[model samples]
Target: MDPAVTAAALDDEHRTFARLLREHQGIVATVAASYCRDPHDRADLAQEIAAQLWRAWPNYDPARRFSTWMYRIALNVAISAVRSAALRQRHAVPFDERLHDVADPAPRDPQAEQQIRALHAFIQAQAPLDRALLLLYLDDRSHREMAEILGLSETNIATKISRLRQRIRHEL
Candidate 1:
């Protein structure tokens, strides 16, 4: 391939990837936000996930599902970020509790909001991989697809999802 053509092709791929990100921005942000207690940190994590997704785009396999691949990368990045932040906090001096303001939950339609808030709270309390698994399950992904995305056996996916649902119910 000519240098200019290769560059152009790469540019096009980036653009397409950007479009996909924009289309699914809410899903990505919600997943990232659920992992963090700080709003600023959530936004930063979402941006980092987007950047990682862009960097990984060149290696994306066309024969596979794009959303599945993207979810795996985004979830991995977000989970790693949360873990790193938690490690740092563990080593830091404790801050004054009075300095922190409680975050008011977002307003939503009463009936729908109740379920959403319950689910969000459940997700925040779970392990990072469990959170990702619940998110994929809520998104209606099939067991085989979830297995492929998480690099687990289909039977494992089914079992994990069942356990996660029980955990979520317990949290609520």
Candidate 2:
């Protein structure tokens, strides 16, 4: 192929990647916020997720939804960071009170806010896999997509979600 043709191809690929990333940037932010309590750590995790997405771009299948692919990569990176941080710290991080600080313009319901805080605390206390499942479940992902992103069977995903729901009801 001519050099100019190759350059144009590369440019097109870059543009596609950029467009996809822009469209699904919320996935990165949500994953980072889900995994990291500190704002600094969340920013770092988001950056790492974006970098990994770029590195993995060449392998992305165009037939699939970009959001699914982005979620898989983002969750994997977030899980790895959580594991690494756990190994280094060898202790659980303190609960971030900032998660409770909701800035809603509408009238706030105190009881609902308390429930939300409890849910956040419950989620934070969960293991990485469970946390990921809860995030996926809360995001209204279908079991098939959850299975694909988490590399579990659809049956397994269903079972886990059922169990997690039971656990939440029992504990919270």
Give the best candidate by TM-score. 2
For candidate 1, list the clashing residue pairs, or say none. Answer: none
Best by lDDT: 2
Sliding window of 10 residues with minimal summed lDDT for model 2: 94-103
lDDT of 1 at 6: 92
TM, every model: 0.78, 0.88
Clashes of 1: 0
Please give, for residues 1-172, the per-residue lDDT of candidate 1 as tens digits.
7999999997898789888888877567656655655656666777898889888888989898888888888888877876795733632212112121123345557787577556665665667778778878878999988888778999999999888877767776
Our model 2 lands, by Cα RMSD against the true structure, at 2.7
- lDDT of candidate 2 at residue 47, scale 0 to 100: 94
lDDT of 2 by residue, 1-172 (tens): 8999999999999999999899888678777778876677778888999999999999999899888889999999988987894533643422344533532345558998687778888888888888888888988999999999999999999999999899889988
* Model 1 TM-score on a 0 to 1 scale: 0.78
Q: Give model 1 RMSD, 1 decimal.
A: 6.0
Which sections of candidate 1 miss by over 4 Å? 1-3, 85-112
